[model samples]
Target: MKKSMLAIGAISILFFSFIATQPKIYAQAGGSSVPFLLISPDARMSGMGETGTAIADDINAIYWNPAGLGFLDYFPKQNPFDENEELRPFRQVALSYSPWLPQFNADLFYSYGTIGQYFDYLQGTVAFNFIFMNLGEFNRTSANGDPMGKFISNEFALGLSYGTIIAPDLSIGAQLRYIQSNLTPTVAGQQDAGNGNSVSFDLGLLWKPQNLPYITDRLSAGFNLKNIGPKITYIRESDPLPTTLNLGLAFNIVKDEYNDLKVAGNFSKLLVKRDSLGSDPLPKSLVTGWDNPGADWSFGLEYWYDQVFALRAGYFTEPSTIGGRQYWNFGAGVKYSIFHVDFSFINTVEANHPLANTMRFSMLIDWR
Candidate 1:
């Protein structure tokens, strides 16, 4: 199974690399395609204001920050619970389904799945992930208001990720993804209206220090660079991928064996330059885009009881110039043995928002 998983990952990376070399497209403000990639697909992370960069430690880490996978508690050579137990590592699998923007359309939805395992021989953790988005079906019409056939829009991504503990308190990870977006069949005059394929990469770092001199042992920080890739072309226009940089911090405010409280904050900035601005080289554009006006910030709090039940709440804010997605989120989770279930809801502050009253559901299974 391990060899098969690794082989699949290797093949996916190579396949996507070749596809990325094809001609690409560009976009203007709010013009980026494949925007589904930015949506939070994990219920736990969505419940926590989509602040997964620092607080991800489970199978969902494949989406938020693969570096956190390095922290999975695999069964060691000598199991403390059972000394006679075999020396094997634990495996985790997660599945999630979300009815996105139900307030606007009930048929549109998103789904995600991931599997992760630790290999003692490699001293690292590896995971495979898949994401899909269904934008629902729409009636096709010609520019002359003529009736045409119906069409459905969809997008998907296949990815493989790896993470390892590089130091006692630091871990790093990377993921390579193959993304495809199919918008419409044949537009009136535009050629190449079929499917667009692109490849992107994600890099993440996590710093988790324990037993600080005067501080708590539960504090941690994380950084992630996501969606770094070449431009993708739908037909005529070419646009950069939705590259972003995220920085986050998380800490346990109250901790004990029976109960614990945690809080986390994350800030994110788009790294792509605007079309109006003259294009700088890739290296320079990344640095210059830091000063861009569009930025997002989020905060979340969670409380757990006996490690079985959890309650969470969070707030997310973005500048009006940047999309103005201000909202509050709430969620809950329960775990029994190796099975877990989580649910999350989103409430937008602005009236008539597409994401108003959105919700997500997720399930997980773990074996040790």
Candidate 2:
């Protein structure tokens, strides 16, 4: 009776925790002035130049797709830490476990995901994740260009994910998350520009079909719906939420225990208020793509060796009608036991954009 009661109590708490996470809404009028936390992170070692479903394994998976954590198979075996293990901390603050420690383990992985299509169970695994992002520090400025104050922007997320062999030749998974964003409010130029707090949730699914007797495990498909939350806005100015629907497909030309190669394509739709996306209203004369209202499609690629090191790259476009701009991405990562670390560099192909040379880092550790 005691055991059963404990199990029921745990379930009740988890259920209520999931409900407590409310969705965020955007302001209606000051549309374009959204917080920078909305920008997605680079999940690929070779910065995928576009936005797509992320396939990440390290602690960073907490940010991209928590479902990837189901792949951890390193439990209940040999010592997770031995004499030769080294402490690895990279540019992004990701923690790499030292093999010298006793019973130490870490898990870090990136998923090769896309926007659409159904994948089967013959391959792939389940996973979990935790993530934190810092938006750097800045001083609040008044209209006269005087320093009014200082503030910071940041985000935190926790996720639970599961993947299963749903069919003889199919594997699938999903993730549920609780996300929070905090951007300090400030008065900028002629108005009070800074925004405050927002809460949201995310859902993701991945599927990989079995390889045919004659065909190799070279192809798979995936999809995800992210940042689907309530509207968030400041005072009189109200904007829609920064919701996005994503779809993608990938091909693995090379796969083995030691090395692998994967290429993928994705499409995304930004579900915010129309006026918030741009200054002018659209006319019937405009014929635009629904997957990416103001942007073009994205392409990404990944390569790995011995599951110890990885490299990635990608490209993204912002259609010509809205003033086209291109992005280039690059990233690299390393894994040791259950600890993993990653770093990525993002920059616009266009030289002069203020957001051009951005950098991101990630870390993950798993111990049971």
Candidate 3:
């Protein structure tokens, strides 16, 4: 209880600190693409270089796939009353020590998200997801480097979801969320400071038939309606949330109690764009569309051995004419006991670029 309280307090501090340090939004200002939250630390090592469908079992499952909670068969053999019955060694709940409820179970999880989790047969899941991103620190100045102080941007979201076994082999889930953004006040001058907030929702579906062809026990499908939020503007000058639609399929070559090999494909579309050509009206002209919407697509492959070691690689690209091509990703991971750890590195395969070799590091611990 003390550890859980400490974790919660830490999460709260980081959440608000992220909000408090946010800078003002500069009107008609545009730069690089919005940096998305990487939810699965384990999946990051797979090289999708970006977000992709990841297998779930640890506490992170609350973010990657809430449906996974239903598949957990923990506490199969344990005493009715145990000391660690309600405690797990992990940063989050310790799955090994946490008991399986007779009908339902609940847990609090945090990775990139600070969330509370609940699951049962009737209602698939009830979860809350929170995300925080620090754009680092930047000074706002004219073409000349003058002291314009510093600025930052931050976001917060509250979400709830429910999923059920709709078909004998199919499960579907949907999430509703409220999002708030503080882009900074002074950046807009006398205008209202462009502190914007909006509401969004997500819908997802998963299928795994009882029987199939060549592959007897290894097939899954998933879809998500992501970022379906209200169109919000920083001073009545609106910009839609980067809403997107995603579809994915995964097949296992060999599904055994000890090991398996799985390959997956994902197709996604960015909802906000400026026609096929990158052209827009007056205000939008200040910068090309935030997302030109050409090839915001990605694909990845993962190989697992004995559920202990894994390897992955993939690629992502927009259009060449727009803002150069995107980047390529490579990653690998390892799992042990009730703990899972992973890492991912992204590099620009396209010719010479300064930020080409930049890499991001991540980790996950599924304690209880």
lDDT of 3 by residue, 170-219 (tens): 66666676766655545433667646677766666667665887666577
Residues 344-366 of candidate 1: C-alpha lDDT, one tens digit per residue: 99888988766778889999998
Ranking by lDDT: 1, 3, 2
Q: Which stretches of candidate 1 lie over 4 Å from their true place?
A: 1-31, 73-81, 142-146, 187-190, 277-281
RMSD of each: 8.7, 14.6, 11.9
* Candidate with best TM-score: 1
**Residue 17, model 1, lDDT:** 22
TM-score of each: 0.87, 0.60, 0.67
Q: What TM-score would you give candidate 2 relative to the actual structure?
A: 0.60
Candidate with the larger lDDT of 1 and 3: 1
Question: Which candidate achieves the best lDDT against the true structure?
Answer: 1
* Better candidate number, 2 or 3, judged by lDDT: 3
What overall lDDT goes with each candidate model? 0.77, 0.46, 0.48
